[model samples]
Target: MDQETAMRLLLKGATAFFLDVPSGMEFGIDMMSWATGDKFKGIKMIPQGIHFIYYSATDKYGNTAPRCGFFHNFKKSECLVRKWDPDKEELLNVPREEIAQYKTNILNLDQFLAPYPFEEQTKWNGLSSLLTENVITTLCPETTIIRSAMELFPASKTENVKRRRKWGPIRTDDDVGYDHLPNLVPKAESQFRFTEPPECHYPPGSSLSQITKHSLDSSYILEKMAEKHHNVIDLLAELQFCYICFLVGLNYESFERWKKLFQLYCMGKDAVAQNQGLYVKFLLAVRQQLDTVPEDFLVDIVENNNVIYNGLKELFRTLESGDFVLGDDLKDVTVQLRRFLQQKFGWEFNGLDEDDDDEAPVIINFDEN
Candidate 1:
């Protein structure tokens, strides 16, 4: 708008000059995909935060490899330059002097490079917030570059039967037949994996048998989940990261991985019953994240039997059952979530039965966030 503000943004935003990017291939940061034209460089006023840059390289025969992307935490006014390696088919960082020169000449270069799509910034923020710099650094141990992070597994016939050609207009995955295709498996051994791999993130080797009714305390359980970490913030970040990696990133392994963890806590009937304190804290964290999940992401989940949704639904049902009991804090979080889901998504939850003549349930309120 104003000169001063424009100058500030120019100083704050980062520049990405990718040289020799192949024509006909798609490149983009976050939500915006760019089909490179004559002047193929990309310049944008990127917010100083963690972002994902991805591309799909295509050949003449219409065949393509798995979608490749990388995560970066940009600093204020950071200038990044990369040259495409035709052999590796990846972007390699340019030399320091070259980057310095590019930064100096950015005013002239602005004419050629495309501006960031401001209209898509809202959607980009929603997606990018799911993964933070710490979370990315922790989850992507082998490589932050997703192409290298992807593990190839043999696909099954069942997978082939259920697989669709397109999940959305954007081709997040390569169009290869599942039977003949290799899986784009996310690494479970990485820092993002549930402490109990393929299940809940309870302390290592801890189980329901070890957890007793007397030992149940929401704060204590949260501490256990966090362990040495200051708080459960890291755990929450991981949950959000895994979910996005699965849903938007088109990593099936990540979906299954997130589901396993989600099901472990939300759907673990005996586990939840025995450890209601832990269950409540977990749900609180999940409720906080629910707002961040976009409607499209939810639609994708709903199309796939709504595993997370159903799990939470079942948890609510269990909590309302006569046999189950919850602390005031847990009950407050559950009720708030139930009300929110009902208003937002038309999900209905039945409270204690009408026939049962009992004292009115006490209502305790907690911060939604």
Candidate 2:
């Protein structure tokens, strides 16, 4: 953006003031972090948009679960506040009266708040461009105050509620049945433990095998995939949500779930071959997300898991096949993404083909949520 626009954004930015945070607590907003200190408060001049603020409390042993944080979309000139509860080792709500007082005397409070590093605003803008207000509101309704994990219990399991830290809801079979081949359900271990399930499933009573049994054309299979709720937008949203849950929430389960979905789209020969248009659309969506992935998120994925790296290779190999055809726009996205992976991660993608016949099909359930 131009300097004039940048100045305008800074002038209309918001403030986030955290109070009573203990020393050694690793607190962060977006990709930045600061170890707590006595005089430290929070971040200021935050651009008006959706942002991920996360923190990990360190115990005596220095262990952190990293499964806590929240997403918020700030209105222009908003002053958001939170206080750390030492006893609970979590951020707690501040009283409305105190909030009002703090805002009224924000000039005094400014001394404690840290200015957002203006030099990083350009990078921040790139990282968060795709995280629109509508997307954040649709995915996270409790934006003002949401935790990565909240404890809850079913009516029958109320006695055990204390032991359960609910990350999210479990999915039902109907929500995931579309991905399976005809009459074949995945028998994988811990199948019930997926953080999130496949967002696309086979059409009602129709599996890949059953659909292929009829020898349907690509357009017909695309129709089948679209018969349910697995349109391109829903698929992209789930993809974006998974990345946030994994990178921002620091949830491994979400990382695994996302990888599985990525693999399903990029590796599932039957699906890709039968629904080329849908596959191309998904590839485009992935490319769009890859463009705006936060620096921290990209670092985490590259350092922690090679899932995306390997997936990219697989996708390129699949694209090279004569069976799959890409238009100019889709081809540009694929080429650009491949180049980005290479330049950013210093890894060459050789487009090596893989034999998928021997691989085990994954199956999982999904809750309506």
* Predicted structure with the largest TM-score when compared to the true one: 1
Deviation in Å, model 2, residue 368 alpha carbon:
15
The per-residue C-alpha lDDT of model 1 at residue 103 equals 88
Q: Compute the lDDT of residue 74 as modeled in candidate 1.
A: 87
* Angstrom error at residue 319, model 1: 6.9
Candidate 2 weakest lDDT stretch, 10 residues:
185-194
- In candidate 2, how many Å is residue 145 off? 7.5
Q: Where does the lowest 10-residue lDDT sum fall in candidate 1?
A: 360-369
| Tens digits of lDDT, candidate 1, 1-369 | 687876677767987788888777877776678777767877667778877778777777857666777778888889989888888887888889999999898888776677666787776665455456766776764556654246545445444343433332322335444333444433433323343331233345556765432132222333455553334556555666666665446565565656655654554455556656666667765765576567887878777766766667656655776366667877887888888888877776555244325332222111111
Once fitted onto the true fold, the runs of candidate 2 whose alpha carbons sit more than 4 angstroms away are 1-11, 59-67, 117-129, 132-201, 204-231, 267-310, 322-325, 343-369
Count of residue pairs whose backbone atoms collide, per candidate: 0, 6
Please give the lDDT score for candidate 2. Answer: 0.60
